[model samples]
Target: MHKRAQVSVEYMAMVGLSLAAFFVIWLYVNSSNASIQQDLKVGFGKQVVTRLADAVNLVSVQGSPAKIFVEVNNPEGVVAASPSSNSSCSNVEIMLVMTAPDGKTTEVFSPVAANVSGDLSFLVGNPGLRRIQVEAVDFFGSPCVMLSG
Candidate 1:
């Protein structure tokens, strides 16, 4: 009877150890996944912001009839907004408006998102404040830049 009790206790202890090991492994896996997700979010956000800033800065000082297009290029061809992976950005709109000193405003639609690479194009004509507004769900579908004359 004493031997049986000792063997049972040993078996229970072994089982407990195995469970603990599994719990530890699970914790590590969960933690790693969380870290990876955070990194991806940050990276995507930066890409969007950088592309916007770049496009804005590229044409801020230029006077023109300019047409610009922002492109999103990625190996997966999927540039999605936060929390969901949409193959393309559906909420993006870009408009170019030239406000004249005489209080005349001429607005034109700019290409918001295209799946391509290299310099983008925007059409704007005249010497004034040319406003370019780009709204998009993601920036990973193509290389983004503003090109104009």
Candidate 2:
């Protein structure tokens, strides 16, 4: 009877160890997954902003009334697309933000392009496929691109 009891205790100990190992691996996988997700979100944001800049520049050069509609895949999480806060085309920068796996948020200044104007509010925080209208317009007596959805 004592031998049988010893065997049962050993089995339980082994099961506990197995569970601990599984939990460690699960934590690692989840952390890695969060990092991967953040990277993909950044890539998606870059693609969307770049396309917006291209459309804006195209319409601006073609003159007023020129417009183009673009469809883009919007990623989940924090998202923002706006003209640089005085960020210039020569500088090639715009500002946005996202969270990291470590629960630390890194502030980023990186969404942008063209002498663009108008409301980019439509593109902010709306996930899934987004359709945006890029039109050429006059801003303060100068040629500018207007973004809308």
Candidate 3:
């Protein structure tokens, strides 16, 4: 009877240890997955901003009355009030607001090389297919590029 009880106890101990080990591994994998997802979201946001900037630059270089249409995808977690107004052509930049798995929020900004400004309200905080209009215009006596949905 004593020998049988000893064997059973050892088996139970081994099983417990295996369970603990598997649990730990599972936790690590879950956390890593969340981190990867966060990075991908941020990357997608940057790509969107870059795409729009490219179109604006193209229109600006072409001069006034120049216009073009570009399609872009607005990633999730973008903020409506984001990308504050630009007072001058040099300060023009678009922003992407992102949220992480841990409930942390981040803002990513991409600058447009040429003078850029316009009503991007429809694009902010809205995730959908966006067809943006880019045009060169004369604003406040300065040449600039305008973006509209």
The local lDDT score (0 to 100) that residue 97 gets in candidate 2 is: 52
lDDT of 1: 0.40
Clashing pairs in 3: none
* Candidate 1 worst ten-residue window by lDDT: 74-83
> lDDT tens digits, residues 1-149, model 2?
99999999999999999999999999999988877888887787767767777776677678888989989776665445555332222323433454556666544444344566555555556677989887877666666676667
Candidate 3's C-alpha runs over 4 A off are 1-7, 80-91, 101-104
Identify the leading candidate in terms of TM-score: 3
Candidate 2, residue 62: the lDDT equals 89
Candidate 3's error at 44, in angstroms? 1.0
- After superposition on all C-alphas, the RMSD of every candidate to the true structure, in Å, is 16.6, 4.0, 2.9
Candidate 2, run of 10 with poorest lDDT: 84-93
Q: Residue by residue across 49-139, what tens digits does model 3's lDDT show?
A: 8888888878888899999998987777766422335454554676677777677788777777777777676766688778988889888
Better of 2 and 3 by lDDT: 3
Query: Model 1 reaches what TM-score against the true structure?
Result: 0.39
lDDT score for residue 80 of model 1: 27
lDDT of 1 by residue, 1-149 (tens): 99999999999999999999999999999988866754553444344435544554444333232334544321111122221223343323333333433345433233334321222232212222233343222236433323222
What is candidate 1's CA lDDT for residue 101?
A: 33
lDDT of 2 at 91: 28
Count of backbone clashes, every candidate in sequence: 17, 6, 0
